[model samples]
Target: MSNTGAVMQKTLLGWIISGAIADKVVSTSCNLSIDQGLDLKLSKFWDIEEVTSSQNNYTAEEKACEKHFIENYRRNEDGRFIVKLPLKENRQLSLGNSRDLAVKRFYALERKLCQQPTLKTQYTEFINEYVELGHMQRIHETKLHNADTNKSFYFPHHAVIKERGNCANSPP
Candidate 1:
């Protein structure tokens, strides 16, 4: 199962880049910094390093990021969790807003992922795309509606995707 773990890690890495982790992270840190004067600058640059550097080191901030990242990616809808990526600075684009940056990053990533030829790559890319809004759950719902025709993927409710079956039932 080592290979599976490796693949999972790689997939998670892609999701991280797809603004899943970073969006939550940057937003969370900014808020914390603002609320507690926690030196968000240092937190921004240091927190990732701290978590990545040592498996043993676990600060409250670091733990918060880890928890927040997972929850936000699942589209938990925490008000504080949603950091609107900024787009304007002094009337013009600030180039610092996360939402704007995420949009740009996602577009670039989409282009790159589209070029790949493998199912794994395609699935990863698809998941990455949905990460921002928890599309995984929706896909599961769609799968259920068309289960007879499409039997390849099992739509797990726990998946980040939303389930739409409750909206209306289909006839056999």
Candidate 2:
């Protein structure tokens, strides 16, 4: 296979291992299959250090997802964070994959991460960074009304806005 082909194969393996394996974790029906393929698949999915420490803890779905993402996604070598952004110029770093797919994968990871309260912190932190970058802002105000039964609700639901930078002027 060509280099791109090899990378693509790795990427597909990573997604299958990480996403699907995570889905089936802790089920008894597949224990034997896991026993037969888990170790080898783990080797394919993680680096040596990660494999050493994490081998015993991962569910098959988690393993599959890990392998999938690692192969397709550009991650820090020390494994601190997965680069969630789409392919960028001047970075010389990419998963050698498509942007739309990365966004889809990110949505998946976001859903999974949000399930853990601690992981939600990462989102908040990223938002803060985005705010600093001026890429994110508060832009609107909602008018609240108490309808017939006397329940109050904001009109237009939750909306985005540009931050006014005035503490008193900020939305409640």
Candidate 3:
């Protein structure tokens, strides 16, 4: 699932570069400055290129990330890959609980849904199907008071609706 892509990206970089040889051919890459947002947009850097090819340089943090990945990644019989969350040797996530933000965002979504019935319907159906398929499960009330609150991962989600193409109004 794309949900695991972040972890996969960090892990796979180690594997991809392990046996790589420096290219003898002269080549260049674009040194792009992109906004810190995730979206399904093409890399718009190709049009602008830098004369150098040393863009493969990895930062010290990235090197540590790759090393952590190499040592912790594994695959099971179900073909799902797993790895321990990569934290610096003596570091932990210095963050607060996200439940408040999640609640706020959910209410915002609910407001949006109230204004767009069709979208709301589509989103409801999609979420119902997802739950039915067991991709997600409702957290039991008893476990909501988990002692290790910081270890909980909160994922944000939304439905993408198509308004054009032969796909019609249906979600692709």
What C-alpha lDDT values do all the predictions have?
0.46, 0.50, 0.66
**Which scores greater on lDDT, model 1 or model 2?**
2
Q: Candidate 3: what lDDT?
A: 0.66
List pairs with backbone clashes in candidate 3. Answer: none
Residue-wise C-alpha lDDT for candidate 1, range 41-105, written one tens digit per residue: 55776866774556458886677666666655533455445533433334632233243444466
| TM-score against native, each model | 0.18, 0.21, 0.41
Put the candidates in TM-score order, highest first.
3, 2, 1
Considering every candidate listed, which one attains the maximal lDDT?
Answer: 3
Candidate 3, TM-score vs. the true structure? 0.41
lDDT of 3 by residue, 1-172 (tens): 1222212122311212223334553873434344443221323343345367543798888878888898999999999989999866767874567766776777888999999999999999988998999999988767766636686755555557766555656555
Q: After superposition, how far is residue 142 of candidate 2 from its true place, in Å?
A: 23
Candidate 2, residues 1-172, lDDT tens digits: the string is 2222211123422322212233333753312223436668787667654635767799976776676777777658798666443443355332333434544665776776668766567667777887999985753333212222233212221112344655887775
Per-residue error (Å), model 1, residue 4: 69
Output the better candidate (1/3) by TM-score.
3
**Candidate of highest TM-score:** 3
